[model samples]
Target chain A: MTYCVGMVLDRGIVLMSDTRTNSGVDNISVFRKMFHWAVPGERIISVMTAGNLATTQSVISRLEERSKTPEERSNSLLELPTMFQVAVETGKLLRETVQDTQSENGEQGKGRFTASMIVAGQIKGMEPRLFMIYPEGNFIEASFDTPFFQIGETKYGRPILIRGYDRNMSFEDAVKLLMVSFDSTLKANLSVGLPLDMMVIERDKYEPAHEQRIEATDEYFLSVSSGWSDALRTAFHSLPNFSFGQPGNG
Target chain B: MTYCVGMVLDRGIVLMSDTRTNSGVDNISVFRKMFHWAVPGERIISVMTAGNLATTQSVISRLEERSKTPEERSNSLLELPTMFQVAVETGKLLRETVQDTQSENGEQGKGRFTASMIVAGQIKGMEPRLFMIYPEGNFIEASFDTPFFQIGETKYGRPILIRGYDRNMSFEDAVKLLMVSFDSTLKANLSVGLPLDMMVIERDKYEPAHEQRIEATDEYFLSVSSGWSDALRTAFHSLPNFSFGQPGNG
Candidate 1:
């Protein structure tokens, strides 16, 4: 399992994904799940994938190859006219990748070779957009009702995002929010681990305004991890003790 | 879907379960998920279930009836020799219930007619025991390293339990901690919801020392719910913002 999140803020898009992948608990591996393409000052697109590694990698490879040789596929990420088109192309590749793998593996593996992705970024004049692409090639763009998209082991980290996300928050705060969300997931689940990949695409920049890979030893991340735990404990203690009509109760 | 947690603390055992049960997002109903029986000074057993309502209800009804009249089906919970035996009996009953339902529904229903449960309580001389019963009739008891069990929609509430649980904490604190955990689950998942059922069985007592059903308007629960949102927001702000070597940041 994987955990990746992409948020559309007033400033830009902030995306974060863990690098852990595993066939089973014992056979763990680290693989980058975040991919990006930017034509300086023209358009920027970022994709974070979760699901069968083979399917995601094949889709990414196809995306990369098609962009370099647009005449072959024509749906090149670099040539996409808008973020919507980019999402459509990415979703199409993901669906084709899953179907191709499944057809080889036969009936039992039909749904096994599938993936989900979060696509985010902007074109020079268009507003930043965020979308969650499904294994079936369909997608939903984030809006005021849902300003963020998360794929993979999303539940463990969602309550924090539901509570902390603010459209007007700064990019730094957005990244910080994602950190806490990811940290909650990491601490609760074994599949999502450290060495997180993060990208901040400032509105209209067409390039990563700030990018960093947070490792287990990253000081700021460590503080956020340990500090959030402490803060939670403090917060837990601050809640009024439950009173079931006990003698010391209200 | 459901969210029910059973925890073992030094002073006693605490169990909490949401009352929401849904066949789909639009078809939701309230149903009690917590059941307990007390022999006053002999033994006290509590069961919290998550899964097919038919299977769980069947298992509980059989347990209840068999205990009242032990001649028909012999592994009656009340007549069990120890807490372990009670758990074994419950597991056997659960497995039989699932198998019976599945056989009637045929092949496509193989895994659907299943349920998981947390069984907790104590017998007069033995220590309190907690077991998580699976649909397969196999079960595992909670131990020092794993002092709690949560079934159905468990992920969202697990981190708080992992961080805040202490075997030595008071029943009030334990209930408080569970309220926060349930609150998190309720906020994140619609299937696990309001009007929580909670019961605490103190050491050596065969009856519930405290039992309460917290409704949507319960003041203490309201405070815990809204207060936790504020507390979490505060905690999120308290954590250090990410520093990607920004000149004014690091």
Candidate 2:
């Protein structure tokens, strides 16, 4: 299991993904699920994956190879004409990778080899875009009406995002918001763990504005986590208590 | 789909359940998920149901009838000497109800007609107790280490309970805490919704200290729902923002 989120704010885009992977509770390991490719000022793209590790790793590796050696292949993620095209290419790779792996195991591969991804990036002169790509090679774009995307272990972290997200919030606050969101999932679920990868893209910059890997001991993260819990306790206490007010008929 | 929570607090027990039930999105209706039978000054027991409506309804009806007509019923729920025995009786009824339905449906009843319950109550000369009864008829008691149990569409509302639960909190505060938790689930899940039913059993009272059905327009509930959104936003902003602090290597 994994937890990843991508948000398209007015200032730009912010993306975060946990690094944990496990076959079973007894066998767990950390694996980076965030991947990105950039052409400096020309374009910048990021992909965060969830689901089967083999399928996601294969899709990302093929994408890297195609981008780095464009001449040897007809397809190149970096050479895609737009963020939408990038999503299409990435979705194609994810679907094919999953299909290839599933076909190998015959009847036993029903729901095992599936994977999904969040694609975020910008092209020169184009506004930032974010998408959630499905294992079936289909995707949806983030819009003003729905400015964020989250996948994997999303429920425990969602209420915070639904309540805290603001279109005009700064990149720093957005990251803060994601941190709280991730922290909620981290506390509730064992499948998502620390050493989270994050990237910030400023609108029209065509390059990452900020990037960091938040580890277990990151000072700011630790503070946000413990502080958020305390703040929640305070907020809960501040709420007006319910009055029995003449019990209703049962 | 449903959401029901039972908390074991020092003061007593607080139980809340949504009234929404649906076969499909279009086929939805209100069905009470909470049922209680109390013998004044002796004992109080509340049951909150989730899962197949038919199964839960049947179980509740059988329990209610047996409790009311003990002369003809050998296993009256009211005749149970201990809260543990009450849970055992309820679990037995629930398992039989589900199995009866499934057997009638033949092989097509693989995962259907299943249900779970939260049994909470107090008996004279004994402390308050809480139990989560599974569809398989197995049950576990809530203790200091695990003070609460939530069933159905539970994830969206869990973090709040996890962070805010206190054994020594007042009954009013406990209800307030449950309101917030239920509100979160109501907001995030369509299948777990409005007109929540709640009961507070103060220790040794052997009767509900209070009982109410929280409607959508119930002034206090409305206040809590909207107030929670505001408080969460404020809390999110109160946390310090993140600093990228020199980009990390990819």
Best by TM-score: 1
For all predicted structures, in order, the TM-scores are 0.95, 0.94
lDDT of 2 by residue, A73-147 (tens): 653767878888999889988889888888888899877789999999999978789999999999999999899
DockQ of 1: 0.60
lDDT of 1 at B30: 98
lDDT of 1 by residue, B130-201 (tens): 999999999999999999999999999988998899999999899999999999898988888888999999
Give lDDT per model, in order. 0.89, 0.89
Taking the tens digit of each residue's C-alpha lDDT, what string does model 1 give over A82-189? 888888898898888888888988888766888999998888889989999999999999999899988999988998898888999988888899998999899888
Model 1 superposed RMSD (Cα): 2.5
Q: For each candidate, C-alpha RMSD in Å?
A: 2.5, 2.5
